[model samples]
Target: MKGFFFFLCFISFSAFCLAQQAYPAAAPLPKKNISIFGRGLYPGDDATYELLKKSGFKTLLLSSFYIHADGDLYSGDSHLPIIHNGKWVGDSAYVVRVKNLKKHSSISRIEILLEGRWYGQPPNTFDFIRDWYDPSKTVPGIVTGIGEQSTLFNICKVLKEVLGADAFCIDDESVYDSPSIIAMGKIAAKLNMHMTLCPFTKYSYWGDILRASDEKVVDALYLQCYDGGARNDIKDWVTALKPQQPIYPIFMVRGSFGTCDSYKGSKSVDEIRAQLKGFKSDYPAMSGASIWQMDDVKKFVSMGCAVKNPASGTATDVAQFLKQLKTTFKREL
Candidate 1:
């Protein structure tokens, strides 16, 4: 009887061990693919497309507004002349040119920038400008305060119709109120658009509201990684938010008090890689990254970095670098 009892005990122990080995608490899901966006109005030229494809960019974030143009700051329209000297001309022709290049390029996604606030218009009545301009004014104009509800809906309608962009980026740098942020997200979802909220680092107070808004309507979060202090500090900021939402680090290559300008830091490519690397180490939730500009990269290389223009680099160089970068830090999805 003792010998039989020992034999049964041995079998039970072996089965338990085997079961534990077979399923060692499934490991956490791996991070998602790293996405990069090129800022500025994508010229869609052969060179731009080729360079971007070579650099391993899967998505291009094309800007509709000339941010630096001398005009009403709230004006979202591209000032590039549509007509000159009785000839229908300017960027429209370039648009066709770019579309052709994109057809044959390796790029798979395109996200057009849609400005949230109207330039020169008072914040409250900004939404009415579009309706006022519209021959059929479905939205009645009214003088109201900056954070009105009706204006928010009208802005959403304009963005859906005029921009027709894949993603809607909220460029309201000044306003960080929760109600406005949530309203924007709600409207974006209604229009079947993904929302990328841009919140400045100076007002860290808004972090909580931003976090709350993320829970509601925000699809992606873009923290301006410039003008603030240290680049590494961004890691901490991102951590504090504990955002499960997709976060895209916007690397500033040019402009005032930007990372590249003040730090005299890494080459544009290196800066992009470094920021993404830092985000990965600190926050596993980070989805991808986007550069403040393509043109700035070119300008920086030409003026500051002794390297050849990114556009002038060999196609092989662009492709190899991008392939290696993506391969080295590929996420599961």
Candidate 2:
């Protein structure tokens, strides 16, 4: 009897060890919060900015920081001034307009984007510094080149000093290595800037990026749900990404750009609510919803919220609608 009992105990212990080796412990749940991204590449005046600021989003990401061949970032045609070689340059009126937003807008943090439309051939906005992958290596987190690191650091400093932008959002399609991504994130954080990931692809080290930056300055991951990413299920994304920071699933508004036309924003409060309700059921921990462009906020509000008059005034209706949306999404972490 004693020999049989010992043999059974040994088998049980071995099984336990194997199970532990097979399945790692689950990661801690992500924080709950909301975020927004804006390319600032739209036509408009202060009224446009005013309307967007009024909408309820925690952080406003000013996007399209086009990087040139020489590791320089340009704002393209943003409403805010772009930092170029340590100096902020843009139209004086537009610069003042953006400064006013900083003064009056209720937004808490501002982030600069590192993705944009390609200018032409090599080293354009979209095709800049994409090659950080080394196929010879097994690890997917090592950045082979250090030049991209310097450029990222410079972008961080200029944005922070000139526009008070202490946050950054990277649509990093170039290199998915953990060592390099984590190192770059550390540099940005060291420079007093919060780093965020904009995951729009099925492949790429999304989870690895989160794990590496969990201990560092990575703040949030905004998963793309519009256009090509529209078919991506939120539950699957949450499982795959296992993000450390809050995850805000983003949607699209009707427009004629690249993939913007893929999904169209419509005027049905219940329909929109139903779609988001499904997301809530699947990802109760999600902070909130984000739109692609800045103008989309107003579009969603006007359509879903049913703005009575176009020219008369739409701010009040949009504000009320956004308030309801925010309340629905403020999930406990």
Candidate 3:
């Protein structure tokens, strides 16, 4: 009986050891959050979402929400109509996918990015705001577009209630009208939505908006460290903004448009690492970093960039880029 019992114990112990070896403990979750701009993700697929879900990004800034020349609001470069006059025109599938990402993934926060850049004409959104926003007029009490609702208010309402957005991101590259931005910020605040800045230049303009706004309204600053802002130093922005919220430096990746060369703010994994390290060294308090947009990430995967393993597709490419950001900002051992 004693010999039989010993034999059983030996077998059980060996099995336990093998089980431990086979299923190692999960790695500790990274301390800092990483953010990404979503240009292509509004209509993205399951495969892309799966990779993004596991990509260690916590914030998803849905990009390029534009207020057209006419008061309609649209998303993405194709200008997929989202709101018209005062009604939801966005596809239900887009809404479902975005909401699902928040529900099932590590992406806890989703911000509607209102981008205004001079492509050919003045940024239509900011120009619209400047023209339409009447500070002399009192903001409407009922936000539900019942009566006397500004187009901006209706847009905010959809972004908050229908889209389930956490915040509104301001990326005003041109048309730095302080009153328009400040007024819009106040409106967003009233809607109980936070506002974040994506500034590439005009420190005083951003500073003016920050100073005039409520402390709770503006929560984070995502400084562009690429393209026109390539010369931007993290420390300078930190000092200028005097931000109460975390400042994340946004990096443009090299795989944009299927080209590996660093141009127009795109950097390789190594360059990104070195830059991130330098930024961290300069400002250790930086909570996270951001990649510009998903369109480039997809382009990188699809256009046959130098990804060592193509079998994994977007997952492999995204992991390669995001791994560098996450590792650089990861907490000390």
Q: What is the lDDT, from 0 to 100, of the residue 76 in candidate 1?
A: 33
- Per-residue lDDT tens digits of candidate 2, residues 23-72? 21211123334455665533247776675577555666776666665445
- Give lDDT per model, in order: 0.47, 0.56, 0.73
Candidate 2 similarity to native, TM-score: 0.68
List clashing residue pairs in candidate 3: none
Comparing 1 with 2 on lDDT, the higher-scoring candidate is 2
**Would you list the rank order by lDDT, best first?**
3, 2, 1
lDDT string for model 3 (1-333, tens) is 999999999999999987644221212112465888988876667777776777778888888888876678887655677887678888777777777776667787788889875667655778777766773544343122212366777788788878788778898887888977888776766676777888999989999988887656677789998888999999999888787777888988766656756677777656777788888888978778888877787677566566553322323456665655556545421
Task: Compare the candidates by lDDT and give the number of the best one.
Answer: 3
Off by over 4 Å in 2: 1-32, 41-44, 76-81, 102-104, 116-122, 125-127, 130-149, 173-179, 255-270, 297-333
* C-alpha RMSD of each candidate structure in angstroms: 13.3, 11.0, 14.2
RMSD of 1: 13.3
Clashing pairs in 2: 33-287, 140-177, 140-178, 141-177, 141-178, 141-179, 267-303
